[model samples]
Target chain A: MISSIGILTSWLLFLLLALVFITNNLLKINIYVRLIVFLNVCLFLLLEIGLFFDDFTVSYISNYSASTTPPLYKFASLWGALDGSILLWNLTLSLFMYFYLKNFKINTSNVDIKIYSSILFFFVGYTIFSSSPFAGCIEANEIGCNLSTLLPFQDLVSSQIGRGPNPLLQNHPLMAIHPPFLYIGYVGMSAPFVASVSRLVLKETSSEWVNVAQKLTFIPWLFLTIGISLGAVWSYEVLGWGGYWAWDPVENVSFIPWLLSTAFLHSAKVTKHNNSLLNWNYVLVGLMFLSTLFGTFITRSGVLISVHAFSNGTIGTYLLIGMLIFSLLFLYIGSINRRYFISSEKLKNKFGRSGFFIANNILLFSSAIVVFIGTIYPLFYETIFSRQITIGRNYFDVLVGPILLLLIFLMIFSIKLSIKNINLKKLYEDNIIFINSSLLISIIFLMLFNRSFNLVVTISISFILISLITLNIIKNFNKKGNSSYWAGQIAHLGLGVLAIGIILNFTQSFSQEIEINSFDNFIFSENNYQIYDIVQENLPEKTELKLPISNGKITKFTSLNIFNNSSQQAISSPAIFRNLIKDSYISIKSINNNTFKLIVRENFGISIIWIGLFITSTSFLPKLKLRK
Target chain B: MKSKKFSLILIIILIFLSFYKISNESRFEKWSKILLCPVCQGEVIYDSPSEYASDMKDILQEQIKTGYTDEQIYNFWVTRYGERIVTDNIARNFEIILIPIAIISIFIIIFLRKINAKK
Candidate 1:
């Protein structure tokens, strides 16, 4: 069978499970259905994996397999192709099914519970039946060196050589873990969203539901944030791109959900603060789930274009159907409850955390809306206008950057305002005095050595630092078990530091386009880059010359590129250079003379972003630890 | 909650306005020649430097600059790349195939419901 048939079978199996789940009142089928569904998922995953990993004996496998492909890469290669990647997607979903089936048991005879089961069924049915990883190109292969093909897979096999994976994917170690973590985080949050929907439509509202549900949502959000950050770091360092977040539609798909989830996190707080907003909270949580499915739809459905999309034609369409159902069904359900949701009278507290919470949701929604427009606008253009208007960094930079800046500004300023009016004079007198002193000390220390200085940035940071310190002191002055309170303060402080890093790093970045061999004179950003010496060398993996580079005597680094490799004497790397957290770009065009070659400009700045990300990543540690 | 909602709306409007202003000032930097070639898929021809994925960056940048209201640019590329413009190709047919199916199915359910209610 082609990939399509296998995936369709998998969908049928999930649908079978859904039927069993719905009829649980009539038939004792919980354990049996779980086992059957698990087996079905496993079967689909295997067949899909086999489509990539098995030999030419299997038509698709032989066509894509290669001799030089390593074992680890061979397995990872399962996700290397369009259909193969869908296989991985199916597997991630299946594993999620396993986890949820084990922990969460549905109480039978409830139609809402049936709806929940069917929701999952919709996801599975769409994934397997339509977007089958085993869809097409079931071509047989002949074993030889890829027949001297120009676009053949790689250096390994001859005419029959199967390409291992995208070279960029194979080059990095993080490739193995990043996609799985990201997908898990993406799918894992579905349960919380589902449970919230269950609680809402079932009209079983309680603080216990909120407490239980928030934990489920929060943990996944934490992992998803970390996963997204790690992915950014990977792209920055590995892709050799000086910058991360190029505003790809695929990246926006991942980001949109995160934005909605951020709203979910905050709106949950509103539910606790005001009993009236409980329905809004449920709707928001459901929307978060719908956003995740929408992301999957964007990826699987082929609505968005990017490197991250994987569509097997009809599978994608099935998913779109599911997404449409999800959106419309939930909207209808929520609208039916709209009358119940209306406030008898609106609470107008101009000064409180509730006000901030509301502001946070709208901005988060605003951010999501902007990204959604940017992401899908191209698809609309292509489909309706028959145009290929590509939305890129410029669009996102223009649209999203300011919105994010606004969010950050709110996040920072939110600290200053409180729900209840308090004695600000006493608080400032106690903490601001010391904070301002520290700020003065640090500002002086920085200005003397560094040429660039900003008083507003320095002062704002002082405010953040002081608020954090004061907040902590206030929260745990008597060693209270309320570390979660301190966790919020520290996390906000980390974001403030991140803002500082962004500003400082952006201010200091320098670049100049010059060839290493010919550039005797170097001038960039009021600083001169000097190349002292160049020596050709050979390595086990690659061959190139080492050029010693310096900016005055303060900086020393090596610049090089491979023109040959160990196995194939002529395998040359596109001139690239790197460090763990930072990258210094080098583009070698051609060696004109023995000593003269053309090269592009040098650009580097991952450290600032990643370090900022690291700070943001660690901010979660306190929160996770505080969770009981 | 009401006050907060108002503040949030106000903040969102301001943010949108700021972006609208920025969009007005920004210029599109198209690299269709370097980022995308009519012949190839998933390859950006610009050279990489300083450990910077310049080729990919150029490609991505070009994709982004596809213009906010790029009715003209998008149409031109669709003619150029055909359906191959996007390699994933999953979501496109969904608009054609599934929307109709979903609509048809929904109506059938509604019709069946009405009959049952009459009975």
Candidate 2:
């Protein structure tokens, strides 16, 4: 009954949205009508929460919310499946729309809200009619059938044993955080997008729209970065793989938008400063919005078989049509307004600040293009040759590596040169000490570690760039530069730090896989590890292996559990002995009666990545405050 | 001015040295990395520990021993397992190469046109 009401409310919200769209005036839309739409979304949210706890009649709840399922996982089941996930997407969009309407309530012609609402309406309508969570239970021969729909005798067995959420999702707490943050990041892009469209439609070249786009872009971009990082952490922790990023299609899709948005952010600043890269900015904003939709389509449409893709369906066609229509609309609008985006100034020097922004945009956009090709090339290949293909991380790493190094070079070089004047003499004079010291330090550091000669050169370059930036920041602080300058300096420092972390961790980290019998003491890398005991636990049936690593002053226990379910999956909950310099990680990969396979890894200086990310995120808070 | 020249030379030397090192890497290692793992997502057969990946790597090693060039070995895999074996077939499919080139070309064209419009 609640499911039926939720579907009904969605239709009502759609009607209200259409009425507002027809008039194209947000102010004319009745307050009661807007209030009712908000209420309708709230009602659906409440119903979902209620069904999660109580209503087994709802097939989704019955399938996911088992008696033994943890309370935390029960709440997470709201987005465990396609239908529930769409509902959550619609809810987030509506909530944002409601807030947008209220925020711009005084304005007579807020077409941004109308456009946003229409988008929300289309999604909500899609959710209700096509992928409704409230649909009646279908009779199936599966083990976990909807017990409420079955006969009394059938309910006796099936009702007691529910299927629960996907085992992989239920395994980790990060699953609860990763998907919501990603969805918010995805949905949050709608505002800047609509604002960009509004600028073109209103035929205005005011810096107002650019300012709006910049501020709105940060909110989503911030969440997207965190979401991506959380996903990497989740993969490292839960997948039993010692690696973080694999350049999977799902990972690439999320990264594509981040890259485009980074380009947009940089170009948007140029648009404000010199009224340049206006059309570039527009294309990026449009692509960002399209890419979010594209990402959603990839994950939900199941056109590609991935660990992350939803079950196969007809949604891919729908999404493809939507993307085409949106692309055509953008092209149509952009051609008409081509004259408006043209700037009066050309870049005077290639080494100037504006040139830096331009270079950054090119690099970022190029990377995004490469990633997009690598991701979609498989599908493209299948279409042309009627054969399956997969493009792995090597394809991307080979392209992106040189581009990133070039970007780092551009960053330091541009920072050294002034915008108006190109003084190579003064630039060299200012950076001479830093340059010498960085090269000296990097060479010595690499020699100390006795790393490969190739790594020495790259690390030396990275060190030099980082040192140059750090010295500049110190000089700026000594001169008492403003917080905004500091923000940029700190953020750039974070990037350098992150790059160093990635390089060192990638080059220096060592892993070994060993098979052991019962309890044994093993010595590796000047450390002793004891597999003290292996105990089998009840309540889901997991065999837990306790591994204690002792290093003179400290001892840490890492548990590896083999979940004996239908899948027969064994996962090791790795214990990380983290220090400022390095992390020693150990986990059990698999267990066969008396024999166990263990993976031990030492990650060198990877803590800086997390620290760098923290610093970078905090730098944006000041900008948010200034905008507010 | 002397320092600037010296630094420029140093950067050039560093880049050259790195390139020299990169060029010296074995073709067998390079080919092992180019092929995608059939069972695992985003994993190259060179890095994956699966039985299939190990077998594929052994074949690549055997092919290299027989004096088959990287292109020929890649072709052998393609014929054996279709286009799915190699992650990047830049030599086989010209369309894949066009993707980045076309995108970069479009950007350059637009940027150049925009700059020239003002001039």
Leading candidate by lDDT: 2
Question: Is model 1 an incorrect, acceptable, medium or high docking prediction?
Answer: incorrect
Residue-by-residue lDDT tens digits, candidate 1, A274-363? 553555566667777777777777776665555566554565666667778877767776666554454312434533666666667666
Which residue pairs collide, candidate 2?
none
Worst 10 residues of 1 chain A by lDDT: A144-153
DockQ of each: 0.05, 0.30
Q: Each model's C-alpha lDDT?
A: 0.52, 0.68
Q: Which 10 successive residues of model 2 chain A have the least lDDT summed?
A: A149-158
- Judge candidate 1 against the unseen true structure and give its global Cα lDDT, from 0 to 1: 0.52
Each candidate structure's TM-score, on Cα atoms with residue i matched to residue i, is 0.70, 0.87
Give lDDT tens digits, candidate 2, residues A1-628: 6555555666677777777777754446656346645755675575567455545545666565565667777778788877678777777776666665565332536666667766777676665656556543454324344423211113222233456677667777998889888887888888778777866777776656776777678778878888888887788666655567778878888999988887787778677777666777788899999999998888778777666777636567767777787778778878888777664455565556677778888899888988888888888778988988776655666677677767766656645545664676777687776786676566556543436544665577678777877777656555654444555666666776777776667667766666787667777667777665565555553456666655556766666654433353445577677776577777765567877666677777668777766666666654654443
